[model samples]
Target: MCVSHSVSPDFCDKVMFLLAQEHRGPLRGGGGAGRTAQEGGGAGRTAQEGGGDGCIALEAGGDGCIALEAGGDGCIALEAGGDGCIALEADGDGCIALEACGDCCIALEAGGDGCIALEAGGDGCIALEAGGDGCIALEADGDGCIALQAGGDGCIALEAGGDGCIALEAGGDGCIALETGGE
Candidate 1:
């Protein structure tokens, strides 16, 4: 869904796109206002380029939101500015979630047999939660906060921070948490 520039600030609200197959190109959900949700095999670019003030939720094998590109059997989410929030949840044999933004809050949850949650925030905050047989959480960026939690077998958390990185893991399986500082 695309909104015109003349539209009001609250023009877009709670827009959702669901696809069973793969979505190529960019799938727009709101030009400058409202919430966007996409669920399916995934999408290449889920939102408008540059930046916009909106919320996005993508759960697919490709990607979600702005410039979101999810891999096979993966979920990706992205948001621009203006109190934007992005949440991605993947459920498949192998689930993966990817999120990025400078001022948006990103949350990724992957639940399946082998789940992986990856989040990156620029001057923002990211939260990654995974569950299933083998769960892993990876995060990177600066001036951002990352929280990772995994359950099941072979759980690992790795965080790379441009400013600071935080990681937390809990489960009965083998778990590892690693944090790295900026360069």
Candidate 2:
């Protein structure tokens, strides 16, 4: 087990005894909820969904989607393996989300904008808020380049990629990039 809540099953609340599964939220992502993973540390499985009453987390082999909120004010989240999302209408309200893709894309979407991320390959590319600006920014864990933000300000970039971003047009202008080694 890569990570566990307690020492033994007697006290373990969320102890993962597998290797083909993973969690991808604030617990490991940032501040989001409904964390999930596909190929981290767990036995091979397609969609083994589990959690608490308030948890809407799901997992799969192709993709994984986990919406931060929208169910209520608590922390409504969902995760899958093929897209990982809580679409606009389904995202509910006050939704915080963190998305990732093993192929070549990862995203964290919020209406007002309040999230962070850390991507791997992603074809060496990164995209912040597709609609607004970001709070804290830094992209330096892609291929070997840095990416640029859309058109706003405060968006930072380190060893990330700039496939589609405008200078000074992004958001945040934030972060001490090139220093850290992850997205």
Candidate 3:
């Protein structure tokens, strides 16, 4: 198994393990719960905890699901196992998630200033949320129930593309909100 960034092999193993923990559950794009992934030994907290790197802390809280913990700047938590589900997270300032990938399901969250969540991805239900100043959620994607939510000033929620339930909500002033297709 090839690990990205500086995540320890042991930590990566644990994250892979949790990805399939029946209790951990799957990360269904933007409208689900579960926090998985870490950087530089930061630790992956379930969506329930609602804090930490690669965490799935949605506005609607629930039983924290899964998270891959790590300790490093710009670390990428990539686990390619688990009933066709993959969850990745990045920590520190200005971390970037998947920018261009098609097909398959991906749940990516960035917790830092000027971080980029999901960008130019295709297919499946994609949910990308960014937390911190100047964060960008989803930008130019295609066909899926895309929901993009960003928190902090100068944040951009969604920017074009996708043909499904597109819900975009941004926090703080100067934030943009655009919703089209479905409710």
Could you tell which candidate, 2 or 3, scores higher by lDDT? 3
lDDT (Cα) of model 2? 0.34
All candidates: CA RMSD in angstroms? 13.3, 11.6, 13.3
Please give the ranking of all candidate structures by lDDT, highest first, separated by commas.
3, 1, 2
For residues 44-143, what per-residue lDDT tens digits would candidate 2 score against the true structure? 4343333333333344333333322223332434332244322111142344444443433433443434433323235333333433455433343344
List TM-scores for all candidates, in order: 0.39, 0.37, 0.45
RMSD of 3: 13.3
| Better model by lDDT: candidate 1 vs candidate 3 | 3
The better candidate by TM-score, 2 or 3, is 3
In model 1, the worst 10-residue window by lDDT is 47-56
Query: What's the lDDT for residue 95 in model 1?
Result: 44
Best by lDDT: 3
* Candidate 1 Cα misplacement greater than 4 A, ranges: 1-87, 95-106, 118-123, 138-143, 157-167, 177-183
lDDT per residue (tens digit) for residues 1-183 in model 3: 322222246744754565445235433233334533322222332222233334432221112222333334644444322233454555677553432233344556666777656532444545556666766665435554555666678776754444655556666788778767533
- Could you tell me the TM-score of candidate 3? 0.45
